[model samples]
Target: MSEPTRRPPSGAATLRADKTAAIAEAVLDELAEHGYGRLSMEAVAKRAGVGKSALYRRWPSKQRMVIAVVSEPTVALADPPDTGSLRGDVLAALHAVADWLTHPRFSRILPDLIAEAQRDDELRRALALRIGEPRRARMIGVLDRAVERGELPPDLDRELALDLLGGLVYWRVSARGAALEPGYFERAADMALRALDARPRRA
Candidate 1:
């Protein structure tokens, strides 16, 4: 059975929650402007029209606040139309990813976040848990369905498939200093499918 829903908090608690959300939004804006390492708590407080103590009361540190900023359910998978073919679904999902990654607003934060992940272990963990894991799971689900439909090998490693797909985008966005490019996702998906089909026979 599903778990029961918890009761909503009182009016004051609700107000505090709203204030916290406002602070988080302000912090996101600041990160967009200044990037992660240079983000200032005092600046966020001023932009949020709250005192630094208020932010500190809610989140102990800048890392914690950044985690909170990204901890929302902003990313999700699009339901495949299942045109009786895995290729179409995979292509569709890839296109969706390309569109998401290419958008100037969303794409700007990624390089920053990834760079931050290199040094701050706590932020890295939180980003992987909150943002990375769910998106990876969605891609894995797409690959799993392809396997079920016999479009790809059943023994294919889902994690590796995700790495391949993500690596293609990461290389362009983070490493090559290029913006999201057209046809990149389709090419990645094609290569991923080929790899899935080319698994060597077990001894």
Candidate 2:
């Protein structure tokens, strides 16, 4: 006698990872093109080549779908590498922020999401919870290590540090539309270090 394998009562979402990934990407494209205020489940389904029902099965609403999909790349880039020294760590953080801000469709999608959230209180809160908080918490790890290494003051303003860490880069790329030139990463890292009053590691 053989035993039958039990499956999810809702069916095999786990088996449709590729389809889910495609849908997520489709959502990004739609967001970049139409903005969150204009995005529709049908548009995403058409772009993804999946039925509208497929989306509903995964998410109860458009906002839920957007947050879940957008949060993937946002959260994935949270943890910067431990480069030992505060300068190295700051440089790493700058690089990570740059990477996320300039990501293909996400670069455009993010700005749209931000614009839409500005007018919608609920959307803003959802973004903060699903995307902002997780990313902020991960970024705090970099400053925490600097504090432990005695490179930063014990009373370091970590939230402020996080702001200054990615602020300039975000402004330049996401707002000012400036290209990242050679040495820009180092310059940004140095500026953040200055802002944080970081003590450089002794050579």
Candidate 3:
């Protein structure tokens, strides 16, 4: 009788995870080097040392793959630290934003992606839905906590507050090319708190 068919090793799960991570890292590098407008699945697969089929197995399209690879880490890194005070929380959030914006790979990738998104509706929507919305929700939670703690008004304009926090850092670091000085986040936090008219809790 024929022997039982030899089964593949049980390492498939681990192998898949490793390949996924490799592909993600390769995607970032490709985007940083080539920008979103020039990125291709072929390039990413070659960079990752995987077959193009490996990428297609994971993501159905280049847009989906790029968005997932970029947005997952971004949203993960964007978890605002709960410092139990609006001022502290604001500083933590801004610091995280500064770190990401100045990161070597992201610093290169983001500006190009932003420029491309301006002209590509599909890309714009993917960025908004995947990266923008999650980050905004987190910031809104930060503001909601501030309100609960009586540190901000119940009717605070969360959208404007988000704009203030993100805009200040983006303009300085990404747009204007200014260096982040020591205590920059603290100073920005103070300014943001003042702008939002944040108040101290009552006994």
Candidate 4:
């Protein structure tokens, strides 16, 4: 059964909640329109219709704000469900990753961040910790499941496996500016399975 609602928010509280949502939207817009290096607190503040202090209250710095906002949805979206087969699991994961990397806003934001991170050591560390690590951990869950179910070799080099999972799609979507066609996910999945020397299973 669904949980019942508690006391509703007061008028002032509702206004605050709405304002915060607006601010988050503004941050993503600012990030997408302007790369991290060029994104400014003033721009986000004006776009959000809130003073810069409001942003400061939420995050101490622009880097923290960008990482927190981008990381939350990213980590959630990349989680691959257990699909009961190595091919199915890998295919599902690749499709999820492709969707995320190709989403209109994210498609732009990520490449921009990647370029900016190359020159900014602080951002590089934050992106790896807050975004990259969490998503990789979820992909590891998929690998561990396959190993236990005897679909993949017991001694799978998991780091390489993780790289294989996203590399193809990420390269096409971000590096080459290539579009993914129908059945591309399957091809990528097959390649990853072959790379890891996965055992064949009955359909």
Best by lDDT: 3
Query: Candidate 3 clashing pairs?
Result: none
Rank by lDDT (best first)? 3, 4, 2, 1
Local accuracy by lDDT, each model = 0.67, 0.81, 0.86, 0.82
* Residue lDDT tens for model 1, 1-203: 11122222345354376667678768768877888888899899999898898888766788877765654523543333465456666667666555545545445566788888899787888888877887776667877766766676878887877777667665776577676457766676677668667432233
The candidate 1 region of ten consecutive residues with least summed lDDT is 1-10
Residue-by-residue lDDT tens digits, candidate 4, 26-70: 878888888788899999999989999877877789999888778
Query: Pairing residues by index, what is the TM-score of model 2?
Result: 0.89
Give the C-alpha lDDT of model 2: 0.81
| Model 3 backbone overlap count | 0
89 in model 1: Cα distance from truth in Å?
Answer: 3.1
| Regions more than 4 Å wrong, model 3 | 1-15
Each prediction's Cα RMSD? 6.4, 6.4, 8.0, 5.0
TM-score of each: 0.75, 0.89, 0.91, 0.89
lDDT of 2 by residue, 37-132 (tens): 889999999999999998887888999888888776677776678888888878878888888788777788888888888899988999999998
- Candidate 2 segments whose C-alpha is farther than 4 A from its true place: 1-15
State the weakest 10-residue window (summed lDDT) of model 2: 1-10
Q: Model 3 reaches what TM-score against the true structure? A: 0.91
Off by over 4 Å in 4: 1-15, 201-203
**Which parts of model 1 have CA positions greater than 4 angstroms off?**
1-12, 16-18, 77-84, 179-185, 198-203
